[model samples]
Target: MDFFKFLYRSRSAFDYADDNPFGISTLLNAIIKRLQQRRKLTLLLAACLCLAAPCYAHAHIFSPLLEAILPRSSSEKPQASTAATDTVTSDTKITLPTDLSNPSTTTAPAVELELTKQPRPPLSEPSLYALLDAEFAANRGNTRRALVLYKQQSFKEDATAVFERALGFSLNNEDVHESLDFAKSWLDQNPDHVPAWFYVAHLALKAHDYTLAGETLNRILRYDPRADLSEILIGIYPENDDDQRELLAALQPIDSQQNASLSVLKAGLLNQFNDPQNALIHINRALLTQPDYVPFITLKADILRKIESTETVLSYVNQARLRNPDSKNLYLYEIRYLLDLKQSQQAWELLLKAQNRFNDDNEITLLAALVSLDVEQYRTADQLLNILVKSPAYLDQAYYYLGISAERQQRFEQAKYYLNAVVREDLVLAAREKVVSFELLNDNIEGAINTLQLLRQQYPVFAPDSYVMQADILWQHNEAEKALQLLTRVSRKYPDNELILFARAQLLDDSKDYLIKRTLLNHLQALDPSNLSYQLSYAQLLLANNRSSEQGLELAKNLIQIRYDDPRYDNELQLQALNLLASNALATENYAQVINYLQTPYDVLPTLRSGELLLRAYQGLGADEKVEALLADLQQRFSFGQRNVNDRVQLY
Candidate 1:
């Protein structure tokens, strides 16, 4: 039903025609006209045959098109009648006949022939209406039939029945165009039908058609007059000056009666068109009208989520769930929010609660699979995603992640098989981009580069991540100048991108060419004012260039204070700062400062240089007793051989 609804309520390509229509009107109009013609013929044939055989018991000859469009059934003669609107049954069998005129060729026995020529069965074959009734009665959860029926008979006044069927179908199939068309037509014919137009407008906007969508919305306003279509039209029709005025005029007449849910939806649509700031404005405005609107809160949360405000998003989504605990979408969204915040334990706990709530829905299952994958529970993630892959909504994603899980488990052959299932261009390109990383890990340099080459061709404008990877590999292989040249070109091509700029600066610093080492590091620091690594590196470089007093000590102190828990914390940087400060104190012969610095132990480890540094520091302080004692301990720690015990020690 959602499929057909999607089709009808969907704006014709004419709405998007820059100079010409979107070019889909011909196909759609053709389907509509064909259905109309078939319907009229069905009526004429049924009426004529009934009148001609007045003496004979009559059965309706249903519209073949209508019957064909319904769920195929063997138990019923395909016919259009409201008498048998049962849920479609799986047992309903249908075999399309090559010859309609030759009735004997089909398994369906001739009704007249059986009535007059032989003993009649206890019951005549069920009419198409009866079959449809059985289908509706079976309640097999077939939503497609309702959508097809509406699309088949939309021209008739009796379309209300078809529309009802379509509405039922729409609950299960959100993408059904038939339900959208019927819903739109239903609203136009019955102005009081609010939900019909609501869904129709939603489908229209999603399909990117604003013209007829505006017309359908105008019909809604004619009844309620307070329905705000302005924001939606403004978002959908940015270039049209008149639409804004018309939308504004419509809103002014009945502004007090506007619904909060519709307004938030409009704002969300605006956000889709790169108007997030304005989107936030509209959503906030809706909140002013209905302060406790859960949908509006969720919409705002979604907006914040897109901007990477994980904490804010979690806060708002939690508020929404508190207000409306039954909202499946909010629960599912919160699970993702927990994952982004790295609260994986909390995420798993919420996932269990959601499963119990939704009765193990496929959408929730897929969401759980994603969270499991994130936390490295590959086997459990595989089991959940395998079931979801059967659905088209998540099929491609399932294949990609299944490939990842397989690779993690060292099932390389299985991983490749799963990866090969992703046929979507974007997914395939992303998979190809990953190929180099995996190949290089497996020690296949040529395979890695070849994979990267193919990826670069497909994603020529994808910001050249492969170039950085390749340059790093080259640097490790000792092709220093070539590595530098590659990074330089990449930086030149994408100057505004911080990653390339940072990489280029690091490469130059590593080149050991002092002439421009400070200059390059300075440029990188300026480009990214808050880059802790570059700030610290610049300090180290300054000290190495004999500029410790000029700025090195102050810069190093600032770097450590700013990034107390930064991931790039290096003991060497801290030691350099301390060593420089201590050397300055000794230069002035400040014995107290020297003693204070020496008291803070050097970070000695599995290194002879650190031991030697410790030995030198003790001797400089003239603490002979402490020095002799430390050297004895060091000799025992790294002893060459056993010797006679003596109070004397030698330093060569």
Candidate 2:
């Protein structure tokens, strides 16, 4: 202990001089004198020596950590600092020496060693403060400052700042790629940072970088495969031809063991690509995993509907309804399938049932009106539409249906009023038809023609019927040549239309030769072979044009035979056939056959043939009873019976 104290004497003397070196010796001598007077002269030296040992021992113990405070100029101010801005000093006082190799080296004899003190290059307070302020500002969620600082970094800590700043910016902004790039930098610095990995993977997904996203997701799975992020990874991963194959390969370990929702999503992807067969297989597998998945059931039903297996679709939808009875959308799906089958009445019944389950639902009500209209249940449709128009959700569609229902009932004025409120141009043609027909029915021929002319001006190429309508109006007004011109234009554009051919025949028959009329009639007849009207017109045309005596007779016979079982009577054809038979008999001078035909009779009233001509035909045949019977019938039918009697007598 004495030797150890002796070895540290030099450093102790140096510390004494540094603090109170010159005055300490004098104070010690005075203390010795005072002790001599108080205690005794003999003990004074021992007491001074004993105190000096402790002072030396204390100095030696602290020498390794505390360095000497070197004397400074009177004018220099002691540096003030905090942890963030602490300055390293040459004159170490109590701080631990950073360089442990030279622990004994001292700034002052009593203080710890200074291996080296390379004073940091002086930075202006404003500049140093700015650097720290920039760090705070970067951390303050300012992306621009953070990016600048990050780019300027050349150290680990600098990179750390950049990573943090990037994360902040990413969360603040919505650009997925920018967020991903920043997260990548952060991952480079802190590859094991879980939140950073999570965000990077998420951003990759949002950026639609499937390859990058998969890689990031794989990294996460490597660390935590069964983490909450597994679902997210599956959602964003590609499901294309090659990708699906790859995914199936990757998911082999978890094939039938995946969570219910993931399996459902996988099944949906298969359905989207039109592989419903495989999709159904996957969905069944998913249901075995979790039978109560409503979304899965809904998806199955939807896919069934897509393939037009309506019965199966209905079956699945019903099953889904049983499982989740409150599903409005499921009922809607059922209604749509029923409507597609033309089972509108059945669809309406389902809609009514749905209404009971979900009353006042605007969508269901709108669907109801549509089904009603489809089935031609106009009155029921009108009632539903009228109620729907009051709700904002269905006003437009309801109004359109209301107009259609009015049109069906021949309430043209009301129909037009409602139809005009419908803004869709697709409905314009139907609206124009109803409006024009209404005008024509009201005896407003010019108005009807003008409306059709307007339609032609608006959609010239599409509304070819306008030309035909204009021709008919013109012919009715006695402008035969103008009517022919319009009819010719329409016929040229729509040469195959039987209506155009028929209309042309009527126009020509009024003003042209029998041959020309017969040609138009035949054109109509050839296009529409089954129509009784066209057949009758063709027979009449043949008779007038002197086409062939046998041909005309055969046409009339064939028309009667073809139309014999037809429920609706071809009144015009039957009358024309009877008149033509009488005319043919008279032309051939077959008096017996003429009398036979005339006596057999055709109609109660001779709408085509004059009554006097009938009486003449009876007289010519010498059938006085038939003539007298016709007179009595005429007396009952006509007001001027006696006045109308023409006595010059030849029926044929």
Candidate 3:
């Protein structure tokens, strides 16, 4: 404690004043204070270097770190009296005195050392204060200042709390990438911290850096094998099949463990990807650990349902139900399979049994009501729905289905009242659409439009779809000009809305208004070039240019060349493109070209238009035998009811 005052000494005082020093403790304190006063944190710290002799050490690389840790105050400022930032205070050889006690050394110190019995904390004073100031700055909403302090605090010690605080602030600011960096820093100091690992996993998942996410989640599982992963799993939302595949790959290492929950999750994802065989492999892996796990069994049954017949899957579900009679999922699975087989009576009976066994089960009740409606048992369906409508959780679904029940009974007014009462975001659109359909049935065009307008106001996210529906209803009611005008006005408000643009394009092409194609269709195509509908519409517009338009032909040909070879391309869109090409050929009186395009469509599955085009091409080529043979095959298909040609054809 007495040695602390010598920390303010010059090099002469440090080398001579402690000649009859208390020991090494007093000598090292002088050297440490000398270096610290100069605001230099030397790599060869004086405390370590001064053990052999009275000396200072080299200083480099840690200057900024020491400056940050030094207390911020005027009194603590570097003294201008000392300019020598040297490692050794003197070149003269010096010897350490052996005396451990002296009257001068025992004198009252300039700074009192009040040593209380407080437990040692993780960080020293300066580093700890840096964290405190960092938090203060954060609470004051000065994020940049707080981050600087947090980073400074981290430099002095393995201050895990400071890294955690920085991470919290970064996340609060929605700076996901920064939060992830802080999270990694936190784990670097304390690798075993589960919460820090979870933070890393969450941020990695958000960035779609699935490889990092998988690695972090694997570390978390190693820390706590039974850790709850539901929150992390829920954050993953795959928007399409490709996204789902990526997410599945990310979860592979996690599910590879012998954990039933993880295995079931992977199996469920594989099933959704429609890889039923792979799904079966993972589900069976899960069942090995928890053979009678109801959800796992249910998933296995579902995966089999994709490959096996409805009856076979139902039998497997029935066997599982016998083993786990109390499981609600088994009952639901059996009922679904029964319904798929069109055994409505058996489904209703099974639902009744389920309802009795699980008397308070709302799911069984809902399923029963739906089955009743399917069988036209309207009174029974209404009774079940009346009960569901009382539950807060099921209120929206109840109202939506009750509306359908009423509509089926031709009680349109009551149905509208019920449907309009649905408030759930998921169900509201369908409910209102059903009400609009009722109005349209009675030639009530204005009422239908009003319903759609109200829907748009109630749910702005659905505004584009509502506007498209309104235009469709108007055009259907012989108000094509009004439909065109309504879409045009809406397009100005939502210029990027493809649905509105598509509807407007349809109206324009129908009314021979090809002039807007250059601006409207070009913008629409550029906005989402991958949208097959836009490509088809744009192709149709070009082909409408005197029927043999080269641009239209090239686009249609390019569409086929690019997408036709891709195994994942939508078959319907490919067929539609082929139809557009055949239509162009027919327009150009190139009968042979028409046959070339329509031949595949006719052989695979012909819509009326494709069949007609092929027939016309045969007749034009004067192939009487081929034309007669085609007629005989078409009549046979219609007679045997092998194919049902769609009546409403696309103009393209």
Candidate 4:
């Protein structure tokens, strides 16, 4: 029974100029309005209203609430006494009609309801006394106290009227646990009551007790074979394997009915449980039931993804897309799967079809642009990105990609213009850095430095990286002294900056300033002791210093001792360390030890440094034939600028 509607009808039509005097609260009205369809507990409700009918003789409680909230066997009429409230059976279940004749519930809460004790003569019924104030508190917006009073008057023996009212209050409060507990109590009293079972099953679902919900749903279906349980079933979410298994087992009876939506839900649950084999069985069953169902179609693809190859999955998705041409999600999935398979031509063709069908959706247009670029369709990428640039949301990214497309086509001038137009802070730095590459490619060192300086000016956090790049440009242009000066100036400003210091030390070493380079490498070690590159630099610098041969040899030996299994050891580092050891031995004229160290490194990588060291070792051992053979190999393999191997060995 919709008590709120019945309460609405009870308000007399005195035409009081837009006002309702019954004082019904909105919270209770909204919660109770959903229950108007169940027409089976009007008898107990009519008695509850009959008590109020005499109390507020002005309310004119004339609505058919008596027979609606408590449904009878159609042969028996509602009696004045509460004698029939003791039996909990199908005949006693409340079934409210959905017809609402009055709009008082919406207008009632504005006027305060004061059903004080001086209203009427005393009655033996205690619930009648409390009901007056309960309605008063409800209209006053004190829903908690109103619900407390409603629950107080509602007992198991003869409490169907007030108990359902209390259940409505509990729903308004959003107390799922409390509602479930109260629903279980009401169900315990009324074992065969469909309305009670309906509420109990839903509350169990809300509380995430899927086993109890599935069991109660079975009972509800037994009584009312056409009950719509879509709301309750949609809320099933199992958190783990055990919960999934329990819920799946409980739903066995429901699954045996072979309903389409239920089969799909079960299939989804099985998929989430990672049992794709069983999930496929149920999804296939659903497809058989409803062949064109989109969810069933997509779920089959998802299940196949776990067991099938990408080619097979993409074939299935393409077939589904062909069948459902208007499905936007299918188009998106097809594009994604085709891209994963590296079939960009197919993806591009599908995207063009989607663009035509979808009227050039901006997101799809942007995706098409990226795909065109991937497939080297420069003209198509340019066209799509140009359109996307008109929209504010996609403007920043559009300009950025337009720059990349132009740059890839060797349109350096146009690339710089488009990239420079990107004003987004995240993309601006990368865009300007690309411009620097274009400048350097044109052999314009000044332009590259100027661009880097602009970046440093705009984004100070990246100033150190920009400064390092500037120094590299000078060093690459054969201006070593100028590069050293720039690094020295920046290093002074950022004395503790490791990147600048490392760049400065490399420049110093290349300029043959070993004393300063060695000092800088030592300071770097103190800053970050685990820096293996710095350690390698220190060993190489010491080996080059004639006076520190013993120290250099010991450090090189320590470095080479790190085995292949060690995290600190990589092939390049080991080879570098070996070259250092062999160089130290050759310096000391220990030809035998030099040969032993250089043999493995020469075999692994015949780099100029290792080859040159081996040639020196062979010469120091008086193995003239080995020295000549090694020199011939080095000449064949590498360029020595204007100094060929024969010309260079004349110095030794």
Best by lDDT: 4
Task: Name the lDDT of candidate 2.
Answer: 0.58
In candidate 3, what are the lDDT values of residues 300-418, reduced to their tens digit?
A: 98799799987788788899898998988888888887887889999998888898798687888998999999888889889988889889999999999999999889899999999
Residue 611 of model 3: what lDDT?
Answer: 73
Off by over 4 Å in 2: 1-179, 195-198, 206-208, 218-256, 274-278, 284-293, 302-313, 423-652
TM-score of each: 0.39, 0.43, 0.58, 0.51
Q: Relative to the true structure, how large is the alpha-carbon lDDT of every model?
A: 0.56, 0.58, 0.68, 0.70
Screening candidate 3 with a backbone cut-off below 3 angstroms (N, C-alpha, C), the clashing residue pairs are none
Tens-digit lDDT string for candidate 4 (1-652)? 4554654554432233114334333323432443334433453454355435434644633232232234332446635334332333323333421211110222111112122212332322234435545665665466666766665555423456566666765566535656677668656645755566667776776577877888887776565444455545544566677777877777766743444556677788778778898888888887875676676788898899888888788888888888888888889987987887788999999888887788558888889999999999999999999999889989999999999999999999999999989888789878988999999999998899999998889888888888888888899889978988998998989999999998888887623798789889889999999877788777787777662567666777778888989888878887888887777777778888888998777876788888888877787777878877877777788853235655566544
Model 1, span 158-264: residue lDDT tens:
34334444444443444334334545555655454344455566556534455555665655555554554433332343345454444433333333335454456
Arranged by TM-score with the best first, the candidates are 3, 4, 2, 1
Candidate 1 TM-score, C-alpha based: 0.39
**Using lDDT as the measure, what is the rank order of every candidate, best first?**
4, 3, 2, 1
Residue 446 of model 3, lDDT score:
84
lDDT of 2 by residue, 273-375 (tens): 6777767776777677557567677777766766756677787777877787788877887787777777778888888788778867877877777777778
Residue 353 accuracy (lDDT) in model 2: 87
